[model samples]
Target: MRTAIRLALPLVAAAAALSLTACGDEDASSDGGSGETAADEGGTDADTDAESQDSGQDGEGGSGDGAEAGTDGSAAPSVDDLMGNWFVDPADPGRSHRIVVEGPDEVSFIESLEAEGDLCNRGVYADGTLTFAPEDCLQQGAEPWPDRSATLVLNEDGTLHVTWESGLEEDYTFSESEWGTVA
Candidate 1:
């Protein structure tokens, strides 16, 4: 009976130690609950999904940047600002003309010079030099028009000096009153 009690005592101690270890593990797991772990992961994923959705919406709405609408979205060139659709001499009906300046690269003039109607063409202005060319002028059967280039210099005193080389290399100074905005 003494030997059995000795063995029984050690068994009981071993059981107690096992129980303590199991309890400690349970407490650690409870301190940092599984529910809290799951919630943290779910919240992170939800935030990422929301950000991706917002980015996708922006791509659909033209990138959500106004720069694509204009050069810088600050100010855009207008017909009035560029001297569009103006009569050379409004007081004299016979000398009236129409000018359509499109953007910074194209200029079309409809003067009252001939019945074939003033030509419509494209031109470029750079470094105070303007060059005008008729549409498809280099193509076959195109009219053999004279030098269709012109140079325009804007004076500081609100006047424009226009020089054309169509057998009439003449310089004309136009006042602000002779030009009007189109729109």
Candidate 2:
């Protein structure tokens, strides 16, 4: 019995360590999911409220060249230009559900499993980064939810590359048959 306990003790410790590591990975940062911190998640709803106030400022509508003027006044691509409804091909695993991008600042996706309700709150990219937090507590059940954040880069060839810290990354290219303006 003494030898059995000795071996079990190490096994128990190893199991505990692994569990802790998994939990840590799940809640580490926005890189884990929407790339938001605890403080950002807490204030995301407020940020949404604040964004409403600035929606009017985004009225300067034009085709997004994905380029902007840097602080040095040099021409650089801005993620803001990519803000618009992006119809993600449902058939593609790399590309999930269709996404309605309000701007680089906000994004919304209709619930894929269930289409009977409002859009499930997700994340958005501003300054070329996307961050999402759980906004609707009622809609999201008691699952371990994490914030997600990622940077968006639009290539001149019309491909979108998303790099996230959560080890989840994808690259999407527009399909001519499925590409069009969102109505």
Candidate 3:
């Protein structure tokens, strides 16, 4: 469907980072996305290719903050702008729902709930919205996640606005850059 195609990258990397770490919540949803929750190692190359093409920005594009710097309300933030960590209200950030965006088309929408932990979903960035399909979402090693979808928008204050397929809306504040913690 249109929703599936609109989704792109992120979950692939996030799953590797959060597969075992509990985020402190719970989702009752079960596996239903695409009904084909199988891992396809064959698709790795294609994902890499797409990420390289979408991330054309170098080290000098923005203010160096993980969040987008420009205040363009009419324009959607680029994939580079979305790359990093976002989380719901939490003092330590490790105890809430999180979104980790790694590239132009890859987005990992992670929940605090154990049942619906890290969902690596494909995302399409268009018209200021990144639409994602979680049905086909996977963990790092192709671990399957429940079927779902969500719409994401970056706010002027550098927060993330997400509306789940279940009609739940939540705002996540920009955390730190994923790169910062790698070392």
lDDT of 2 by residue, 56-115 (tens): 223333344545433334232354444443333323312233334544544544322221
The lDDT-based order of candidates, best leading, equals 3, 2, 1
For residue 125, model 2's alpha carbon misses the true position, in angstroms, by 2.3
TM-score of 1: 0.38
Question: lDDT per model, in order?
Answer: 0.35, 0.37, 0.46
Which segments of candidate 3 are over 4 A away from where they belong?
1-75, 113-118, 138-147, 177-183
Please, what are the lDDT tens digits per residue for candidate 3 over residues 14-100? 455555543332231332234222112232222222222212223313333333333444124556666666656433333355666
Model 3: per-residue Cα lDDT at residue 9: 29
Which window of 10 residues has the lowest lDDT sum in candidate 2? 48-57
Error of 2 at 39 (Å): 28
Best by TM-score: 3
- For residues 1-183, write the lDDT of model 1, one tens digit per residue: 554344334334433443344443434433532322211334223222222211111111111222112222222222233433333333332333334454456655444332212334465644444566655222111113344565553323222334456423222222223232222
The superposed Cα distance between candidate 2 and the true structure at residue 124, in angstroms, equals 3.8
Cα lDDT, model 2, residue 75 = 31
Stronger candidate by lDDT (2 vs 3)? 3
